[model samples]
Each structure stands twice: as structure tokens, then as C-alpha cells.
Target: MILKDALPQGRITGTGSLRTVVQTVFDVLARFRQYMTHPGNSRFEPLFEIAMQKQLYNLLLEWLSGETTNSPDKVETTAVVASWGIFGAAVQWSRDPLHSTSEMMVHRVSEVAAAALAPVLGE
Candidate 1:
């Protein structure tokens, strides 16, 4: 429940350091991968209903707005939307029979998310 824990807390940090944001993103993705791979869970519907997702998106948008001097709007929107897609893909990747491990899926998704947000974060 890392996402649940993180989202309810609000902003990742007051300074909004790019490193912190990136790590947070990585952590979230990792937790998601863990949840998806759990033996008891077979359906994806419950994950979508978690309020944490919306809160996480809003937090990212807020962070993006504060961190970016130019094109904050564009960056926030793209990052938020791209993150949703990336997370979805990560879930799907976890569920895929070909993927042997959740760890690999988490790493791949985290890398892609970092690359996608790096520019906007000014890192």
C-alpha cells in the first residue's frame, strides 16, 4: 500500500527535488508491480479504484508546476497521462506469462518513467 501511504500524505517534499520525485515514482511503480504479481489477485479492477492513483497524479502535477519554469502545463499533462499509461503497461507486463519476474517489470517501467519526466523535472 505504498501508493496509498504516499498519496494521502500530499507533496513528496517541500523542495520538490527531482531526485526525490524520481525515487517516489520508482517506489510507486515497484509497489504496483508487487501488488499485481501477488498470487491472490487476478483482476485489475480494484487497482483502478484506489484513490491513491488520482492523488498521485495530482501530486505529480503540482510538483511539475513548481519545478518547471517553462511549459509547466504541457509537462504536467504529458507526465500525468504518460504515467497512467506506463503504470497500466507495467501491470500488463506483470500479468504477461512471458515475463518471469516482477522485479524486471518494475525496473523497466521505472526507467521509462524517469526518462519521460526528466526533461520536465529539469534533471
Candidate 2:
């Protein structure tokens, strides 16, 4: 469920398909998590993350280059960057088992999306 769906009174002040876009971002992260923590997985987690990150960055750059006045690209960019940052943190956490930065990244993304959704959802 997305922040807008979870918080009915919330608003989404971003571009089109906010819920769908945000959900996809979350789903990508979920796949990354599965690859990272699972035991005996054939797919290498690091390579998977690197590939995911590249795809995200490419999409973001494309969105940025588009000449739309009201672009969802900005929000998309934020979501992708935050997601990758957190993924990196998760990798570190697994290695050293120290602080958990991945969780922090999730929170940050949620916060932004919540606020962005607030206006639209409140309508």
C-alpha cells in the first residue's frame, strides 16, 4: 500500500500516476532486499543492486531531460536516489552489521511521498 492509500486524507502534489510510480519504486527495493538477505541465492546481490541502480539513474536522467513544465521527474529522481542510497547502506549493514542506514532511507522516502501526497489525497 502507498502512503496515499494508507493515509486517506493525504494529498499527492507530484506528477501523474503518483501511486503507481511510488509503488514500483518500493517494489524494486523489495526485490533488492530479497536478493540481499536470502541464503543460497544464485543471483549475486551486489551485481543486482548495481544493475538496478543503473536502471533507476537512467530513467531519472531521461525524466530530467524531458521538457515538460510540470514533470514527475523530480519526485522520481528523489525516490530513485533515496532507494539506491538505502540499498548501499543495507549492503554495508550486512557486511559490518553496525548501523542500519537502509531503514533511514526508507523513512526519508516515505516522508517525502507523504508530504507530496498530502495535497492530492486531502482533496
Best by TM-score: 1
Q: What lDDT tens digits, residue by residue, belong to model 2 across residues 1-123?
A: 333343233333333433334444555555556566768664676676676556544443343334333446554555466446534544444455335454454455556654643432342
- Measured against the true structure, the TM-scores of the candidates, in listed sequence, are 0.58, 0.42
Worst window of 10 by summed lDDT in candidate 2: 6-15
- What's the distance in Å from true for residue 116, model 2? 12
Instruction: Estimate the TM-score for candidate 1.
Output: 0.58
Tell me how far the alpha carbon of residue 32 in candidate 2 is from the true structure, in angstroms, after superposition: 3.9
Off by over 4 Å in 2: 1-14, 35-37, 68-123
In the range 52-91, model 1's lDDT, one tens digit per residue, is 4565576667767777775866876865775575556654
- Stretches of candidate 1 above 4 Å error? 1-10, 13-52
